[model samples]
Target: MFVHFGLYAVAARHEWVMNREEIEAERYARYADVFDPDLFDAAALARTAKQAGARYVVLTAKHHEGFCLWDTATTDFSAAEALMAMCRELQPHMIVNDRLGIPGDLVTPEQYQPSRPLERDGVPVLWEACQTAPRDAALFAAIGEWMHRHRRAVHGAGPSAFTAPSGVTYTQRGDRLYACLFDWPFGLLHLPDLAGRVRFARLLHDGSELRMREIPQAQQAFNMNPAAPPPGTLTLTLPTRKPEVALPVIELLLWDSP
Candidate 1:
């Protein structure tokens, strides 16, 4: 929360009193005479700042009044220290932005999407992605609801984490992986990573089971014995060319071994 309270409050005009009025520093200092400490309640202001979703608050100190509200050696009342102490006592968890003459949290980056998730010391850090969507989130909720309602055999499937190629996304609930295909592939939707991990595959939109085959890429001349392919490069043969729905989602029951 930004509290722009200072000598400007009594000025009744603007915070830039000296600059706008062309008053000298010595003349502007006279505004401090009217500064009434009785009028300002720091604790009440801090409470209001918290209710406004402000994790932190910044106060306007040493404003156009030329009166040093805090950090003064002449008076016992160090307004800066007192105000901050009051804010800390009232809202202990509240962060104080730099405007209060304090060091703050890490520098925040906004309005951009990173190629990969941001991490510090190998730990993921909170980052923002700049993406525009319909202001009404109900559209997204409706789409998710439709997918959940038609989950069918793939409902409550899991392996927790699995890999799929680009343009595809998957969800795991119990023992099944529901792969939502955004674009229709040619003849086969090859899941190279799931070569040995998947036992069965089926179209979740319909209850039709799919046929799958595993082929090795590494082979020699007249290769009687083909070398075993690495994990996550296996291929599955899908029966249907395409599903009737606009976005086709398939369900695969994973296997433990090849």
Candidate 2:
């Protein structure tokens, strides 16, 4: 279970309310004055997670908005020490997403960590927050489901050289390659990198096999120059109807791991 609670809760708006609305820092700091989390019971939260069969809970101690949920000597703009102690007691693995002028156990990609070390007790676990509107349950569910389905690729995969149209990103994990398509193409998706490397292709969503073929690059008028490299255009036939998900992923099994 993951929980996000801070001064932003006082505004009853999204987490990035300060930045998205372009409010001044001093003006936005006033939210901390009225921030009263009287109903925030860390023990009750832990009990609820246990009832729901959750293994662990991750609480956002400080978000990108730079509002600290715990009291610190560096800033008076804090929720105070009592809440932080309770949270630490209930949830030891707290996530401090912003630089609060204090040392933290973990650091996110967006944070600047020049003075602090990346790892201390163990390998630092990187946390990536998915920014989404409140109550957008479908999108959240889709993202969580996608991550769960491709847990191996999510952890072990790295950026791939494989090329695709706009809104598409590629990642490869050993013999398997993944293409995350954010925008649905018309009817055909072209991949220029995996010309002869792809052994199989399928949609990850429903395990639907897709038809694919390679076209010689020389066949195109753009490659009229004899010095031009040999053309190997790999195109996958996509379904006319797009899948019902936040993002669609196409899995490619390569003949050789690159």
Candidate 3:
């Protein structure tokens, strides 16, 4: 069974209310404030699926509008946090595609391997390359986050050469600088390139604010070596608990062009 439920249902027009009606994000987000799923019954739905001989169930936890169906620390615009917990208990291996929100390993490399072509009349068949190995839940979430938030920002500046720990990459879109952290940092993350440029910082997953501070030149040298970080290095204090997403993105609202 496949379920498609979201804030768009409140509009009563269609699932594509944001796109079809050309509704702005600010306007569309209002529906979440008033969203009430009074008739939702996860257990009953599971029972019905079982009676219908369904093997598995899938839920669209998040949609194109970025409304989450499950309770998330990342956002308050969720239908119900208990819904996800209930669904998990009912179906341990239940598949969830949060519409680029929380894609739970639906496609694996083994399942989406390259197809071998069969020859006919000694003519080799042309086969397209399978580009699925590198694609994971995190990549989808990143793509969705970019489209939902930073798509309108200019993208010609290319990647930033910011100094930071490994597994971190920076991309600039106008005044907004996105830090894609493949590996979650411990308690603090430092970016020397964004010394005095940052005006605000927040995690894209839940829109939670992060605290930042500038490291003075006096503290730049650890052992009086040339490899020390330069002065004016900005340090961001991250939350102890990481978000539920595969890849966490830090959206920095810059005071000047990055």
Q: In order, what is each prediction's RMSD in angstroms?
A: 12.9, 8.6, 20.6
Q: By how many angstroms RMSD does model 2 differ from the true structure?
A: 8.6
Cα miss at 123, model 2 (Å)?
Answer: 17
**By TM-score, highest first, what's the ranking?**
2, 1, 3
lDDT, candidate 3, 1-258, per-residue tens: 455689987887666779988998899889989899999888976765554444456566876677877777774534544556677899887554332233332322223533333233675432222232231434444555544543322234344445545777676777778887888877778887677889999987668899988755555445532233556678888887777765678888989773
Candidate 2's residue-wise lDDT over 88-166, tens digit each?
7898976544344444444554533232224436854444433333445454455566665555455666656566557
**TM-score (all chains, Cα) for each model:** 0.40, 0.56, 0.39
Ranking by lDDT: 2, 3, 1
Off by over 4 Å in 3: 1-130, 133-158, 161-164, 219-229
**Which candidate has the highest TM-score of all?**
2
Per-candidate total of colliding backbone pairs = 11, 1, 2
Candidate 2 TM-score, C-alpha based: 0.56
Winner on lDDT between 1 and 3 is 3
TM-score head-to-head 2 vs 3, winner: 2
